[model samples]
Target: MTTQQLIDQIKIKKSFLTIGLDVDLEKIPHHLLTLEDPIFEFNKAIIDATHDLAVSYKPNTAFYEAYGIKGWMSLQKTIQYINLNYPEIFTIADAKRGDIGNTSSMYAKAFFEDLNFDSLTVAPYMGKDSVEPFLRFNNKHTIMLALTSNEGAFDFQTLNVSSASGSKELYKQVVETSQTWENSENLMYVVGATKAEYFAEIRKIIPDSFLLVPGVGTQGGSLSEVCKQGMNANVGLLINSSRAIIYASNGTDFAQKARIEALKMQQEMEEIMNLRFNV
Candidate 1:
């Protein structure tokens, strides 16, 4: 999907919410295991229940990778279901893969072409060469990890690095440098909601770029705080809530509960967009 298409969905749905599909075998309802593809079944119900309330669905690739071939097949089934039913809703393969140039291109093809994901998460630790191949795909987004919500982010993301402007924060350097490699049109950064305060400064560097923000619900990142700091004229944020939404209940009512949680977030996001952009 193009950036405009994504933003249009957010507007049409009155939501910037992206539901994360981090399905755990042990966490799903016991009854679902009877199905041939429990992971895909869980995902299907979640999508059927909450697809209208959400603008995107992000399936973290590690969850499927852990289960090997069967898990991968489940993920494929889930993607096919989404593409067939809700083509306009953005799909992200949260694979966070980054490698040498040739390998990166293959990874890009795997997610963008074969699996048909609209975007994929990419790590920027290896620098431009590792990330640019993913960006090369037409209209597909490369979500580069920036100031993450993870606890270990402090280990390096904040380290002061000297530049012409004196000491610059590491993440600021990454965002600035990456912007030089590719403009915001096809590039989005993963700015976690736990690092909400940093969004203000990051916005100064690239105000219009969309941010695929995780950590909103289960990770305790405040939705209001993130929108307050990160929202731009274009409503440039995709705040994800995973366990809190997907596993709202371990019972058969899980799908409805997920929709309830998603609606609450989407309603708030609609109000935020209105107050920030249309007001």
Candidate 2:
């Protein structure tokens, strides 16, 4: 989907919520296991229930990779279902993949061409050569990791580094340097909700770029705080909530319970949008 298309969906739905489909067989309801494709069944139910309440759905690739071939098939079916049924809902493959230039291109083709995800999460530690390959695809987004919410982020991302512009956090440099790449307009970023304070600075660097924010709900990040500092004129944020919504219940009413959880976040996001953009 184009960035304008994504923005349109956000406005139409009055939401920038990205539901994470991080399905785990151990945690899903016992009844689903009896189905031939429990993973896709679970995802289908959740999407059917909460599709209207969310503007995006992200499936962390690790969840699918864990199950090997079956897991991959489930991942394929889930993305296909979303694309066929609700094309407006932006899809993200949270693969966090980056490699040498040639390898990155193949990875991009796998997710962007074969699977047809709207975006893919990419790790930028290998620098521009590793990421620019993903940017070559028209309309497909490469969401680079910036200031993450993980505790270990401080180990590298937040470390101060000497540069031509003087000392700055590594993550800030990552954000600034990425804009110089070819087709940089297609770039989005992963800025963890837990790093809310950094949003103001990050925004100053790239005010127009969309941010895929995770770390709300189960991760203890406040939605209000993140929105307060991160929101731009276009409401440039995709707040992701995973386990909290999808695992709301392990019972038969799991999908309904998931919707209730998503609705709560969507309502909160609507209120923020109304207040911030006067929508």
Candidate 3:
């Protein structure tokens, strides 16, 4: 989906919530295991239940990769189901992939062409050559990692670096340097909600670019603080809540419980939109 189309969905739904389909077989309802493809069945139920409450769904690739071929098949079926049933809801393949240029191109094709995800999470450690291949795709997005929510982020992202302009933090350089690459307009970013204070400075660098923010419920990132600092004129944020929503219950009513959790976030997002944008 194009950026405008994603923005339109946010407006229409009065929400910018991205529900993470990071399914764990161990945590899912026991009854679902009876199905031939338990992962897909679990995802289908969650998607069906919360599709209306969320504008996006992100399935972290690691969850699927763990189960090997069957896991991959489940992922394919899940993306297919979303595309066929709810084309308007943006799909993100949370692969966090980055490699040499040729390898990156293949990864891009896998998600953008074969699987047909609207976006993919990409690591920027390899620099422009690795990430630009993903950005080259038209109407698709490459969400580069910036200041993350993990404690380890302090190890590098926050390190001070001297540049041609002046001294700047590493994460700031990542945000600034990325804009100079080809087709950078198609770029979004992964800014963890735990670093809410950084959103203000991050926005000054790329105010219009969308941010896919995780670390919300389970990680204790405050929704109000993230919205207060990160929201732009277009409400440029996709606050993702994974475990807290999808694993709300492991009982037969898991889907319903997931919907309830998503609804709570959606309602908060609607209120923020109304107060901030008057939508």
- Superposed model 1: Cα runs more than 4 Å off: 182-184
Q: How close is each model in CA RMSD to the real structure?
A: 1.2, 0.6, 0.7
Cα deviation of 53, candidate 2, in Å: 0.6
* Model 2 TM-score (2 dp): 0.99
- Cα lDDT for residue 72, candidate 1: 95
Q: How much does candidate 3 score in TM-score?
A: 0.99
Better of 1 and 3 by lDDT: 3
TM per candidate: 0.97, 0.99, 0.99
Candidate 3, residues 1-279, lDDT tens digits: the string is 989999999999988999999998899999999999999999999999999989999999999999999999999999999999999999999999999999999999999999999999999899999999999999999999998999999999999989886899999999999999999999999999998999999999999999999999899899999999999999999999999999999999999999999999999999999999765
**Per-residue lDDT of 143 in model 3:** 96
Which model, 1 or 2, shows the larger lDDT? 2
Query: lDDT of all predictions, in order shown?
Result: 0.90, 0.96, 0.95
State in Å the error of residue 100, model 3. 1.3
Model 3: which residue pairs collide?
none
What is the number of backbone collisions in each predicted candidate, taken in the order shown?
Answer: 0, 0, 0
